[model samples]
Target: MANLESFIRSAEHGSFSEAGRRMSLTPAAVSRNVAMLERNLGVRLFHRSTRRLTLTEAGEAFRVGIAEKLDGIQAAIAEVATGGGEPAGTLKVSLPPSLGLTYILPLLPGLLARHPGIRPEWHFESRPVDLVAEGYDAAIGGGFELSPGVVARALAPAHIIAVASPGYMAGRVRPADPAGLRSLEGVVMRAPRTGRIRRWTMRDAAGQEMPVLLPESVVVNDPVAMREAALLGLGAAMLAVPDALPALESGQLIRLVPRWYADAGAISLYYASRTLVPRKTRVFVDWVTDAFGKQKLAERFAGSLM
Candidate 1:
């Protein structure tokens, strides 16, 4: 199984040396493992010339059939083994910058404790990432914005709420209706990945989704920064419930529209096309989904005032 996975990763990487580094094996060891597999199969998988390791016709066909499936099986085995033994291996994941810091980072330690052998390598970026080309095992972010050929699993849904600090609301009259969103100063977010302003969406009385327009006063890309600004009374900002939960509880922030909120949609994890998900990734995904699913963000703080 090691030989098969190593060989397949080497092919995807286009160089045994590169694949060796990713797998943490010596180049010589990688070559030997491939050779053992070739001997067992009685076929030349790679036409290994001095210049480059080229996949033979048979190798190409074999990879097409087994690569992703082999990866998934390997992941499952590792995850299942964690209960009795340490799940030792590197797992790579990609996520949005703000979500990675605020949500995933906090949950990571527990995951590592449960599987002491698993080492997590996280890539947090605002730009759209190519999971397969970048070799990420999985990713977490808003909705199902996965690239073609990827698979996604929804973990939890979050609603967007407009919030400000108590000081900001102390001198101001709160709007009694959703249309009142237009009168307040808005904090605009420039999405680091898409380079677009974070849009606020809400359901009208008729239950039709509509975009809320507010007076833009501050624009930023990072979510944490935006949250901080909102706490300091810069302006009202729309944020995911999970991101705003702590501040709301601490009395550092106050909800603007208590009953009306934007529909932020679900958060999910996306992975490259594989027949079986890697064991570590599956385990983490399961844990995260199970952990966050119990909370209903929209209903929890509907009338919260900090």
Candidate 2:
């Protein structure tokens, strides 16, 4: 079973180390398992290379045939072994640092109190994770190009609004329109993907899209740092609601243009996709969805500047 599982994980991740980490084994152990499987089958499953593992034709076909059935079999074994189907395992997840800290991180206490059986392994990341290839149980972020065998559940609207510290806006004329923002100092975000300044058009109730650029006063790649810069009265920043919500509520920050915002997309929880969703992952998904509802997050953090 270890040998076969190792083969499948190696095929998926194309790396012995990643598979080993996910399975709680050493890379050498995983390699040995794969070797044993190949010997037993009398065929080479992967073309070994220094950088990555590539599945051969027979390996690909074998993987396709056994993937679904193996999932079912493993799930069944786990269910029987655990007794009463209680979710008790390492729940690996990837989370965006700022947004995860602001919103999702708060729910940990309740989750731990409720399900002490479940152990969480959360990684704070800014890059898009390959869920299957990296063996993550889940990932929560925005603008993910969905990998196959994965799915998304929307948590809240990913809306960005112009915001500034009250001190920063004190001596300045508040912009009546999005175009008026150009004269103000700007704290801008650098895109991690392109390493360029990120820009977006603001949309009004009249459905007009207007391009607006703020004069740069501060620059950063992190949303948390962007929020900090705005709070420190450096300049106005186009901030996503989740990172801006607390400061806005606390009077440290105020929304700049009450009728306009950028519709970035939804902040979604990317789930672990398989034949059957694991019990731990399912409970986690439900817990977050329910908490977001209770807090009326979509309403409080709603993109509409009004």
Candidate 3:
């Protein structure tokens, strides 16, 4: 078990030293343990180099099988140890910063109050994370590629719309349709995974798709920054309705092309799969799902443009 644990941790971090820190052992000890495991298994698990470490094909197969079984075993042990007590543990979760701040963060206080035993550690970034490999308990965001042994529960559909400050749009003729947007100064977002600026395409109330070409006045990488740019009247931006809702409600921003919005996929809660999911994770999933339902976020997130 010690050898297997060491091997798994090393594989997850891709560094003996980092895995050692996690396991509270020295790097030398971790290396020796993995070495013993490799000998016992009669296969080389990793190709070790001074600059980097990579798993062999056999190692990848072993990791897949071992990781699942290990998670199950740990969950079973945790269930028995708790004796069905209140969920308690450090819950590590990841979320996109803009959505987390606008919608989810507000509910944290109440969540903690209800689950006094649970402590939350949240990482807010737009980049996708490997839940099991990085040791995240769960993540909330859109467009995450579903990895093996993980599952997602949809929180709300993500709808995006064109928006700008009323000040910016005041003198400009309101776009009567998608084609009219090409004349406006646009605040575009650069894709994080790909450096290219994102192209705009929206669906009308009648369900016809139209692509709008905006002349770029500003290009940003973060959603919150993009919203701020639009509010500053830098230019018009395509923003998720939920991210722009508060500003729109406060009259800081206005929705343009009232009948068009782009479908950006759903915001979902993702977690590892196990026969016995840890109590802490289950409670969080339930709590967030209920919060979204209670707030009617689904309808709001769908956008009012329709």
Candidate 4:
């Protein structure tokens, strides 16, 4: 196990010294562990040099075969050690910044209190992440294309609505229909992957969907920033209902057309597939699902309002 771990870490870091630092061992110890593993396997794993370390072809194959299995083994051991106790490990996750801060962050304290052994390492980004390739335990967001060996559990619907500050709407006539929004100044978001300004298509109370063109006055790349622009009375902006809920509740912002919203698909928690799922990930998935259920957030996230 130590030899496998040493080899994996060394390959990842590209240096035995760095791997040793990570594993809390001396560089010589890491090298010796790898050397022993190589002798037992009867193959050179890495081509070592004073300047750099490169993986041999056989090393690449071995690492690919063992990396996922090693993670499973580690998770299994942690699970057994904590049988009937709390799950423990560094839980690495990726989340969308605004949604994570507004909705998910508040739930963490409770989760952590329940599983005190768990440590969370969270990355906040809007882009979809490759969970396995990036070594992430899980990710929470929408629009993720699930590759093979990955699965998702839906948490809530990502419904988008058009909103603007009361101040911005005061002098202008309120939009009675989607066409009315055409004349309004728009604060829009640019697609991160495509770099094109996103167009808004909304569904009315009758379930009719149509695209509305707004005269763009301010353009940004982030949903959070688009909300900020709307709050500043820059223009009418399209934002996720959850992202805009706080401001809407506080009366700082108002919906342009009450019964209309855009469907951006469901927000989901994504994780890797394995027979013996990691207890840490399982607990988190259940906790989040329960939290959303208890709060009745699914209805809210679905854009249902009084």
Task: Please report, in order, the local distance difference test score of every candidate based on alpha carbons.
Answer: 0.73, 0.85, 0.86, 0.86
The list of candidate 1 runs beyond 4 A from truth reads 14-18, 38-88, 127-133, 146-151, 191-196, 204-211, 271-275, 293-306
Which pairs of residues have clashing backbones in candidate 1? 72-276, 75-278, 75-279, 76-279, 126-193, 127-193
lDDT of 2 at 174: 98
lDDT of 4 by residue, 1-306 (tens): 678778987998899998787556799999999999999999999999997679999999998887757667655655675684778767889999998998888999999999887879899998999998887889999888899778999988888888899999987999887778888999998998998989878887687887878887899999889999999999999889888988999999999888888888999999987766778888988988899899988887776452
lDDT of 2 by residue, 1-306 (tens): 678778877987899998887667799999999999999999999999899999999899899888657655554444543574677667888999888888888899999899887878999988889876675778888898897668999988898999999999998999998899998999999988899999979998889888878887799998888999999999999999888888888999999997999999998889757666777788889998999899898787777734
Error of 1 at 31 (Å): 3.2
Steric clash pairs (candidate 2): none
Segments in model 4 whose C-alpha atoms lie over 4 Å from true places: 15-58, 64-85
Model 1 over residues 1-306: C-alpha lDDT tens digits? 668766876787778897787667788888998999999998899988667888999899888877656546555544454543544667888887776787677888989888776778988875556677677778887655567668877665556787888898887889765568777787779876578887777664456555678677999887777888888888888887777888888889887767666766666678765554566666777767665655542245332321
Model 4 weakest 10-residue run by lDDT: 73-82
Q: Evaluate residue 258 in candidate 3 and report its C-alpha lDDT on the 0 to 100 scale.
A: 84
Can you tell me which runs of candidate 2 are displaced by over 4 Å?
1-84
Model 3 residue 261 distance off true place after TM-score fit, in angstroms = 0.4
Q: How many clashing residue pairs are found in candidate 3?
A: 0
TM-score list, all predictions? 0.74, 0.79, 0.80, 0.86
